[model samples]
Target chain A: MRGGAIAILAWATVLLVLFIGNWIWDAKPVNAATAAFAAVVTYATGVALWLARREALRPGPPAPRSEPESVPQSSLAAVLIGLSVGTILFGLAWANFLVYFGAGILVLSLGRLVLELRSERATRRRLLGEEEPR
Target chain B: MSVATAPRARLARRGGWPEALTSTDHKQIGLNLGACSLFFFLLGGVFALILRTQLAQSNMQVLSDNSYNEIFTMHGSTMIYLFVTPMAVAMATYLVPLQIGAVRLSAPRLSLAGFWTWLAGGLVMESSWLTADGAGRTGWSSYVPMSNSTNTPGVGQDLWVIGVILVALGLTAMSICVTVTVARRRAPGMALLRMPVFTWTALLSVLMIVAAFPMLILAMTLLFIDRTGAGHIYTGFAGAIDYQDLFWFFGHPVVYVMFFPYLGGAAEAVAVNAHKRWFGYTAFVVSIMMFSALSMAVWSHHMYTTGGVTNQYFAFTSTLLLVPAGIEYFDMIGTLIGGAIVLRASMLFALTFFLQFLVGGLSGVFVASPVLDYHAYGTYIVVAHFHYTLFAGSIFGFFAAAYHWFPKLTGALLREGLGKLQLAVMVIGTNLTFFPMFFLGNDGMPRRVSRYPTHPEWGTLNLLETIGAGIIALGVLIFLINVIVSLRRRIVAGDDPWLGHTLEWATTSPPPPLNFEAPLPPVRSYAPLLDLREQQLDRERRLEGAPA
Candidate 1:
């Protein structure tokens, strides 16, 4: 995974260099904007990757973790959040009331998301407690 | 800590339609996305059939010019925005985690949310047909001033703008999640270069999406504003050029976004059936990175004929693409050389994918030149080039993936007989449908017109294309029948049916809720399973040599 980050960074660097060339050669505003956006995204992602793990900057293989991980099965809040976003956007083009309706639903879904996260954390803690040495 | 003391025995509910709809499981989200994509594919295919019918004979009254324009626009939009691009994300969402030996997707909820957002966007786009003015009638690119409210005034055009914005948003979100999952979830010792070929391609694709999709979202938003009379955002020649610049930035890279994953799938199928690791793995990776970069840089080549963009720079970048593309062909041939090869349905499709895409790529070289593009732009030659790449190239690669991964997704093998028949039909149909357009294009037939003057050879060629379109439809029907038949009377495929190299094959067919139930094998190289096989064979040979 760390290696993947470095690879992306390397690719990003190449794109950034090419972007500079594109800028100097023909200074089209749109071209400069696109190049700038791509460069910033790549650079920001590289920084994020480095922050996530400094080793991403100099990677070979990922370090293994021995701990058991708990994975959730489903989330209703997620589904609602998705539907609400679509509804809000669709409403913007189609009807006004739907936009408000979607926003309300979105708020409720976010609240539900919090609850779901809390439940997941509780389950994880209990499982961890059971696995601890007596 | 207080929350930890609360009820921890509560489990997420399971088993029902609601569960199916709301499930955050990456596999479910992927399958859902795929199902929707297939539905859109059929709808888009119907649109194409109608279009071909209209074009079968000169000045046919099958559809009015207005209706014809709408259908063609919808056809291109449905296929590009709904089917191919989302399908790429679908594969990534499903396979990336399993390939990397992760139990769940990173940000699974976000992925689920993205799926619905995208699905809703597809529905809204289609819903434009119900409008009083009809659907978005501009070509899929929807060039401004023409697409401006003054020119194409309608609720439908507004819907189209909003639909594209939502689609971009959804796909972008999902792609980011896939990228993060690949970046964070790889199993220990699975170095980046040692990752499976498919994962590497998927990673590159999602990264390209991350870089490019924002431009699309911004384009659609501004287009919406331009349409709604908020401001005369795109006014004159400069405005049109600016629109093209923005549109093509997303537009060109989106082509590769649609290509790379299926290319990965085909490459994997070829390598597995050839009984070898992919040849030139490091070179292949570097080539794809260059390919993606060059693709981004080459966006203005699409705008070269407009004379707004730097023709030489774009041409250079576009022509340079041949380098990476040529290396890919070389690597594929190298993998097939001196190897025990099997002509399975998957392998056949994969091989054909390469052979057919070459036609598209070579034709693309013709248009990359400024002089040639002036002749080819807005003609059927351009149409033929893209259809070859997208349909003949990507769709075939997609089927190779379907044949390769179907057994893993469902615990049954697709019927080999039906698979081969479908491939044969599609190959014949696809060429018949698109190959003639090259001649028509060269001979000076303009595109996006509902009618043409009754020229002698033109009618005959168009008739052939129409017939070919029907054959393509028949091929798709056969594939559907094959899938249904395979599922009903199942031949149970156990884990690792193809002796697959990736971690996904290490799990059970139709993997369990958390993907893998057993501990994963040691991550030795890119082809970990193949590594295990070689180690066992070496051990057996060593034992036989020892004195008993």
Candidate 2:
């Protein structure tokens, strides 16, 4: 839910700013359309992530001990990148302009951020002793 | 503490050559890294000589652009993938397990795989020139449009891509293993605070490796697809700026991978040689974390003149890098303040690192500005600056680690007096070789060109640089001799040589399968061994005070 809210806020911001940008610069039809479709896809993905974020890393204090937990950052990055790129190039290629750009940016931003946040929690746990939770 | 509980109680006293080579041991891993890094060091040094020989005369027709490309590429690959990373990785692999007082590296089998993969990767990357693409003239970062499929047509680029991705994977696997081992396998009393500085740096390096490398592999995969017609990676079919985004994302962190461990090694050496605690311990830790974060943000600095995102924002972040860089230097200085300096080979390297890396960092501050980058971007000055910072600064620090720990790894002492002499020559030589490139860059001499129009002024500086290069070569030769003669002699160093400040030195010089019998000390400060030494010294002083 928090992830969805964050994505929505970011998409609305990208859309509003770009709409005003297009209004000011008189952006080409393709670019304007790109901005709109991008926004919608961003929202959709955000909802999906919010629904599924539970299956990802459980938000908690980092590792339960001082020993290093081997967080598989690489495997996660590879899979997310493959999916995001695949979505942009194929699935979203012919989608509305807003869908393509919005989905791409959303996945790039939210997806990476969420993974990073999970890793951040894990790293913090490793770095700071989980002697107690705040 | 009894002999029964010792690590060697489980293994043999000695193993033969074939047995050692096939051994799934951390000790073997260390030896493998050391030997291979040394060999690549010599190979890179030879390439440097070829480059210097060509540059010895400008417009001389001695080497073509393609030739220069191959030479510099091999030189760079050798230094980055082979020399610097391997040496530090070796130091960490050899020392971290020992420092943590573990039975063995967490994944010794994966470690062997990493070594073999690294060896293969280096060979493949170096041999890319012999392929139809004639090696990547796009340089090490291989930034796009030029590195893109449209301009650079060749299997060589594809080979370069494959080689580097493999190497990155190898490093990632090794570092992840190290992280797991350090986390789960420490001796009973060892705490996070008690970990050695080298181990700490290794952990940070491992984290950066796991996080940063997938981007490179992905970027390379895209490029590979573009070449094979699977997908448009760098070309505009997919997007134009994508390559730059991904490359710098990984490339910038790659720079940290090159220096951070050496920086860690230097920190460890300086603290012990000065016989004082690392100053501002908590600040150093914070700076390490900050440096890692900033490393991610500052990737855009490489693209400053390209006009993609916010150049000003990147410049600000780039300039902010100085804070952590400064804090690290200050901490080293703090260790030296009011402390008796031992001035060992390691200390010499650390001092040089402080001075030279500051120059690199400070110079970068000037370059970080968009205005300055417009004038100086892509110039030899940029080359000189990085060499000073990374090669002179970090590479020198790595040499220090090698010399400092060689004794412990091999159960022998290096010729310390010779080590100091070679270290000084290396310092002077490195400065002479790279410092003037700043002026050349300011004067607008660009990088990647084979020849220059000789003016008496430029000629003098070039000659001086050549001389410096020769001096550096001499220093390297001296290092080779030091390793060879000492290891052959095996002069008994015992454990705890130099009154070392980490748990690694607590074990025998050439430790057995396990590092230590007891758990590690509580790591609140930088130097746990110093803590142990002080505690022991205090006990002696107290016992003498008591009725004896």
Candidate 3:
């Protein structure tokens, strides 16, 4: 994790150097703006790493996690959500009815996703409880 | 210490055809994505064959000009958007979790969703063919003014724009997931530097995707709106330049995005077959990061001849690409030096990948100079240059990876004899097909044209290229047959074939639902299994030396 943070920061630094170089040479709004966007993405990723664990910023190994994770085997909602987004976007160009149809499916999928997450959480809690006293 | 909860056992039991379509497991998603990408590759190849047939002789009018335009456009689009880019992601999604010793992806469901989104996007884009005007006839880049509704007005073009947006959006989502998984879900001892070579490459590739794909989505979305009469955003010279700026920002980095993961795969194949750990691992890592960053900065090189860009700046940054590229080549050579090199099919493909990419890289260096680019831009030389890089280079690396990992993915080995034969045919066919284009371009042959005026040299070269295209198709046919034969024969490859170096080899072939079943061995370095083997050898030597 620490190394991942450092790597992101390192890449961000490379981007910053290039960004400055591009800015000084031409300074076109489009060029500068795109370069800036790239830098922001790099920095944000670094920050996300930091937020995930303070250990990501420190020179050490990741702390071993004891809790067993509940890995989902399948998610029909996920599949529906993906297809619906594509359908809605395709509908934007091709036909209007698909847009409404896709939006409806998207809403239903989101609801189903929430339920799946809840069930997953409950399963994790039950497993942790079984292991707690042992 | 970790104890994995087996809560999904029941679901795993039902992993039939239906589960494969909706599975949140990284491996399943990766396989599905990869299989779909291969289908797209075949489709694109057919388009290429047809285009080559049209261009076989001077002034041949087998297909109309507009139909030729649509074929070439879809060919490029399918190869880039649907095949190579997604295939790279597929490899990473399938392998990264195993390489980093994670049981599952950080957001498994998100990864599943991304795969479907990308698939749907591909389908929608292809569906453009059903429209009255046919598929997106504009080139894959679809430069504005020319691509604007005023010039190329059609629902097909509109659908192309929408499809591109969705593809970028979906890949971006998946890339973010992979990025976070690397940042957060690595095993306790699998520090970032200790991660396998492919994982690092995948990391950098996804990082570039996270940074650049958004620009693609934004550009295409604006283009879609502009097409729908919302605004005339890309109008004159400035508008055209702005559109190029936005599109190329994604365009150029995507070449590297298409290259790096396969480079990682080839590097692994080379190192493993050579019986060596990767040479200069730290330097390789640094170079790839620098390489990717530099690629992002050099997009304007494509626009230099347009006279609207800062040629000097672009040329400088573009030429600087040679440095990192040189480091990678040197690393490959260093890995091979004084090592027990085995010419396995995977190794041969890997070696060929490096060698062929050099031709592309050298040609790129020629075009990097603004003076040379003036002559080369919009010519067959440019066409030849990219095909060498994107197809000859990346496809070889892709095959190397497929050969190396097919056993792990399917619990069976691909036949070496057939694999080698395919490689030989492909090498001959690829070179024969694309090499003469360089000469054609130098002789003032233009690209993307359906017909050509009679010229002895141009006509002859076109004929050769058409023949080469047929040979390449035959090679692909053999490969498909090999796959069918190998699967039926089923030469079961057990866990740890080739005495693999990564953590993946520690698990079963076609690994279980949770990836690893037993406790993972100690993670001391990038090649943990290799480290384990060396330690065991040392212990045996010490025991042999002791008094008994």
Classified by CAPRI criteria, candidate 3 counts as: medium
| Candidate with best TM-score | 3
Clashing pairs in 3: none
Model 1 share of native interface contacts: 0.63
B1-548 in candidate 1: lDDT tens per residue? 01111111011224766777788888888988998999999999999999999999999999999999999999999999999999999999999999988888999888888888898889999999999999999989999889999899999988988888888888988998998887677777676778888888898888888999999898888888888778778889999999888999999999999999999999999999999999999999999999998888888888877877778888888999999999999999999999789999999999999999999999999999999999999899999999999999999999999999998987778888898999999999999999999999999999999999999899999999999999999999999998887777777777788988888999987877788888788787888889888878888888899532
What candidate 3 gets wrong by more than 4 Å, as runs, is A1-3, A54-65, B1-13, B546-548
Off by over 4 Å in 1: A54-68, B1-14, B546-548
The segments of candidate 2 whose C-alpha lies over 4 angstroms from its true place after superposition are A1-134, B1-13, B237-240, B517-526, B546-548
lDDT of 2 by residue, B1-548 (tens): 11111122122245555445545567666677668877888998988888877776567576888889878877887788778777767766777878776767766656655665666566666667677658756777776667766777776776676677667766766776676666655554455545667777776676566656777777777776776677764655225456766667667767887788888888878887887777887677667766765675566678777665557656766887888888888888888999888988888887888788888887888788889888889897788878987888888888777767876776677778778888888988898889888887888777878888877667777777788899899998888888777756556776777788877877776666555555445543446668767878889988899532
Better of 1 and 2 by TM-score: 1
Worst 10 residues of 2 chain B by lDDT: B1-10
- Residues B384-484 of candidate 3 have per-residue lDDT tens digits of 99999988899999999998998888777788899999999999999999999999998889899999999998999999999999999988898899888
Question: What is the lDDT for B90 in model 3?
Answer: 93
